[model samples]
Each structure stands twice: as structure tokens, then as C-alpha cells.
Target: MKRKATAVWKGAGKTGKGTLSTQSGVLKDSNYGFSSRFEDGEGTNPEELVGAAHAGCFSMKLAFVLQENDFEAEEINTESQVILEDGAIKEVFLITKVKVAGLENDKFTEMVNDAKDNCPISKLLDAKINLEAELL
Candidate 1:
């Protein structure tokens, strides 16, 4: 299966404005500008969108991993942090809290690692990835 998204920009960098649309229509011509990306603005940016994708992908991966291990989690909350350095995305840090029962620390860590390694977004990203998982 293939997924697609489109970004249209007008004007030069640092002063340009753009809109991003996804095939799913979750974001249709959403606003993205220099201020939105570099400064404070009331609109979405690429990093934020990437964070959303990473979070969702990791959660799904964790769910499947847990199921395969005969464990079930009440919820998996993940926060994906994207770092922009030298005009490029440098790293992605994932902080996750897993609400699970009947699992030991070692097993939980193993499952988390599996998810981190198997998530589609994590696999696609070239940046360094970090993960923190907790059971509660």
C-alpha cells in the first residue's frame, strides 16, 4: 500500500507561506508559514504533523506487539518530539507511557523495543530515535 501527502508553497523561504494536504483529508490546505514553522503562529507545521504520525504509528506497533506477547494494554500514550537543527530534522524522541497489567519490567521493555524498531515511521526516519516506556 502507498500513502501520499502534498505540500504547496508560495514565495521564498523564510518569508514563504504554504498549505499541506493529506490523502486522508485530515489536513486540507492547512496553513503553514515561516512564523508557524519557525516562530509562534496559530497554525500547523511540518514537525508537528510528523510528530502526530510518529505517535500514531508507534502506538499501533505497540498494540500489535503486546497482542502477540499475550499481553494487553489499557492505553499507550506516546509523545514524539522532533528536533530541527541546521535546517534539517535531526532527531525524534519518543516518550511513552504504557498502561498495562500482568507484565514484568523486562517483558515490558522488550515489547517497547520491538515496537520502536518495528514502527513504520521509525523505520522510515533517518534521525536518531529514543524511547521511554512505563507501565501503570
Candidate 2:
């Protein structure tokens, strides 16, 4: 149950360039560099990738939690914000919106909290993580 990705960098500092690839080829040879990470550029960045992973992980875990409790959701949308401060990742904020029928607010909040705390990505992150969930 292990996965891997590779990053290759050429040159140094702001002018440097790199490529990111994953074992599954989802991001094969994707371009990333200082501009992509620090400014508006036409490529993906590490923080965005981490945000995507966090959103996906939290949503999936929430789905499982709902199913286990005999509840179902029409849709679940999540957005993860990665905050970089002092040249380091400082916080991750997870914002979730769910469309569910006949689910109690307290129970839904409980499950969301459970997913936020128990998701594998959440567990792996070393920074502060916060969740803002809404029922729609």
C-alpha cells in the first residue's frame, strides 16, 4: 500500500525548472518551477497538488463515514487551501459543502470532523488543519 512520485530539477533558484511524475502517469512529466510555485505560471505547483490530495482524501473518507452510518449524500464538494508562510507550509484549510437529504446537522458535523481527523492525508500532514463544512 505504498505509492511513489518523482521530481527532477535542473539548475538553481528562481530560474530553475523541474518535472513532476507519478507512478500512475496522472502527472507524467508535468512542468513545475519557481515561477509555477511562486508566481502566476502555466503549470502546476506542489501546494496545489497537496491541496488536491487533501480534498480528495477528505471527501472519500467522509463518503465512507456516511455510508457506514446508513446515510447518503447527493454531492460533496471540498476545497483545500495550503498556506505557505516563512518558506514553509503552515496550515491546511479544508472547506466542504454537502448536499444530503434527511441528515441531522449534528451527525453530519460529527462525521465531517471524523473524516478530517482520520483521513490518511490529514494524518500525514504536519501542519495545522482546519475544516469548515456546510450543508446545502
CA lDDT scores, all candidates in order: 0.92, 0.94
Clashing pairs in 1: none
Candidate 1 TM-score versus the reference? 0.95
**Tens digits of per-residue lDDT for model 2, 1-136:** 9899999999987898999999999999999998889899879999999999999999999999999999888999999999988988889999999998889899999999999999999999899999999988
lDDT tens digits, residue span 41-92, model 1:
8789989988999999999999999999998889999999999889888899
Q: What's the alpha carbon RMSD for model 2?
A: 0.9
Off by over 4 Å in 2: none
Q: What lDDT, from 0 to 1, does candidate 2 have? A: 0.94
- Residue 126 in model 2: shift from native, Å? 1.3
Model 1 alpha-carbon drift over 4 Å, by segment: none
